[model samples]
Target: MEMRKEKAALSSQQGLNHSPFHTQEHMRRVPPKEPQVTCRSNTYPKGFYCSWHLQHPTYIPTDFEVYVQHNQRPLEVTRDEVHKNRCHVKFPELFSSFPYRVNVTAVNSLGRASIVFLLVVHYHLHRGLFGPTVKPDPPEKVVAKPVANNARRLEVTWNSPSTWPDVETFPLKYFLRYRPLIRDQWQHVELSDSISHTITDAYAGKEYIIQLAAKDMEIGTWSDWSVAVHSTPWMEEPKPITSTTESDIIPETTPGPPSAAPRVGEPTAACSTLLWSTHLLLACVLLSIM
Candidate 1:
């Protein structure tokens, strides 16, 4: 009987010990992790920093910590309040060979920290991110070369820069500006998100001074203007042409002679010559017939 009682007591002790662990295990379920950082471009540009974004996550971010390391050495340290569960960090010193990491810790009201998730930061320092520095290209050569016969339009071409860091996309936005040779005022044109542009609608054969600059939305900074270029359109002399040439070149033409009477000295040289020749021929015929 004593053995039976002792066995019952042992079983009771075992049950009591198992209940606490079972309840504790059931109560503790890990919360979901925060989202990862994302970028607008795949590659970060040279001499520029990148912005990393961590948006809303499974849990609300009330307080947070960020630690950035380069070559496994801490580079940046920051803390922020949670709003939209988003954070942006700019690393101006990031370069191609620099291997960097970021770890984020999120805390709850109870003061518990979630396991740190690692972030990878990449750069193109020595060699460009994707391709070799696009040949350290000089801004396109703008000679402002003057063309004969006042040239009316400007055609521009540039050598691709030696380094175009990889971004989400390319053929980025280009900015152009110019001033007429005679005017001190400046005129500007924006090529809505394109890398190349042809400037027309300019005075033909006129001397123009122009400038250009470019940037990628994914990239952080705008590239310097290509070498300042100077160009002049070849001046074209006015020429007289037949009606056929006029009709082809000029879309709108007078269907008939002008209704307004010619004023004194207004008759064109052609009209005056035709009138004089007709009178001379009539006088000659009268004399011959006589």
Candidate 2:
């Protein structure tokens, strides 16, 4: 029995010396250092995620394992495909007073290291845990101008906030508020998914104060109001013209003379008188001649 024990111990030592993983150089390799882990609830009550990175490299390929516990019960963890160092877990119960404990372990052929984190879930404190908390900044460079030919309409335009990195992934909606300077009440309009809007009910020729605010369509809080701008509805003032030259004023014309009238009466009487005067003159001539 003693010989058999000694032979077994000798065989184990020989195997360790000859093993590829137990080589002198490989045994000298450093073990993976403890990872730095951070956990946050992205969309409160919906889910939470954790990310970890090694404090120091172990000079060998390493793999990560994430484990979550709630009230001492193990919860399932899902790895994020896009982020190799990150993993996500769903909330079993929202607003639970019990804390969640997470442990992340980094393993290599040489050795393994681990880190642990404790998180408390609160609904109100987590502003945008249902989605990303990255809210767009207030719309910048906002301008309000009256339409050129519209007396009661104003056109407003603005550019998207610069802080919003991805517009395609997270579309935004807008709210426009305006009121005449003399009135205390304000009129507001919500735009579905546009950066420009036309105010069709503005008081004609009145000066108005206009402002804009924006928010993500799926998540996040609305941004603060943009800078206020003052503008008035378009109006055309009447212009008078003064005539300084005589050519500009037309001259009045005088009436023409009356036309002569044609002979209408005493035509028969004048013919008879002419015939009797001829007969008398003929008789006197005959007497003189005789």
Candidate 3:
């Protein structure tokens, strides 16, 4: 099966190289349409690749050739088997200001056509290709603390990734995610050109899990999230009592006699006076009777 597949691929390549419909004389009589070419660098200092396709079909076997020139000097070009119409070229220098000139030519039994592309060496070109591999390292020493006197705010700070060598040239943006320990959903914030951020909507007095990640502003993937940190917002303490305030809270009182009841007939002085008067009245009545 493998041998058969290989044979089939070779046959297809041969068929694309030559067409029976048009002879050499007929190819000279008719020409193919211009070929469209696109080139991009996937890795800086390594190389770039270019791919081309004809704008119109010529109904004949066609061949493509890619050529690259830098600073008026030609560079070596190699065919890419993955893409029959694509080719790769290595950079002569790591960082060169010279622009690259790429030409793609399509030739067939019917005719020949060509197109050109000029690539300028800029930061964007390098970033677009190898941005994933150039990711910044995770942020360092991430810390989260509650803002003083604020129950719903947390302050987070971190230093730039130590692995990133050129911070000035390629500034990094930050992504911070936080969530309460009891919650499954996370709240995220994006910070540009900042090392510190204040979360104004944190859950009051709740322990929160926090982390940070960073990436180049214009290119590269975000670095792995920084080591997680835990923090809860500050809670106000109960107020203390003062001398003046305490005095206002207390009420004044006067002294009072014990609430004991007096004996029924023990109003001794008044009761004795009444009994004497009654005895005198009785004696007067008896004398009258005699």
Tens digit of lDDT per residue, candidate 2, span 1-290? 99999999999999988898778666556888889997754333456778899878776789998899999999999998999999878878755667789998999988888888887543344432333333456898999988988899999999887766555655689889999999999999998779899999999878999999888675656777999999999998779887578778878888789766647864576798998999999999999999
Better of 1 and 3 by lDDT: 3
Cα error, candidate 3, residue 103 (Å)? 30
Ranking by lDDT: 2, 3, 1
Best by TM-score: 3
Model 1: how far residue 176 lies from native, Å = 0.7
lDDT of 3 by residue, 179-246 (tens): 99999999999999899999999888899999999887876567788999999999999899766866
Ranking of candidates on TM-score, top first: 3, 2, 1
lDDT of 2: 0.80
Better of 1 and 3 by TM-score: 3
Each prediction's TM-score versus the true structure = 0.35, 0.42, 0.43
After best superposition, candidate 1 residue 280: deviation in angstroms? Answer: 55
Clashing pairs in 2: 42-129, 43-129, 43-130, 44-129, 44-130
lDDT of 3: 0.79
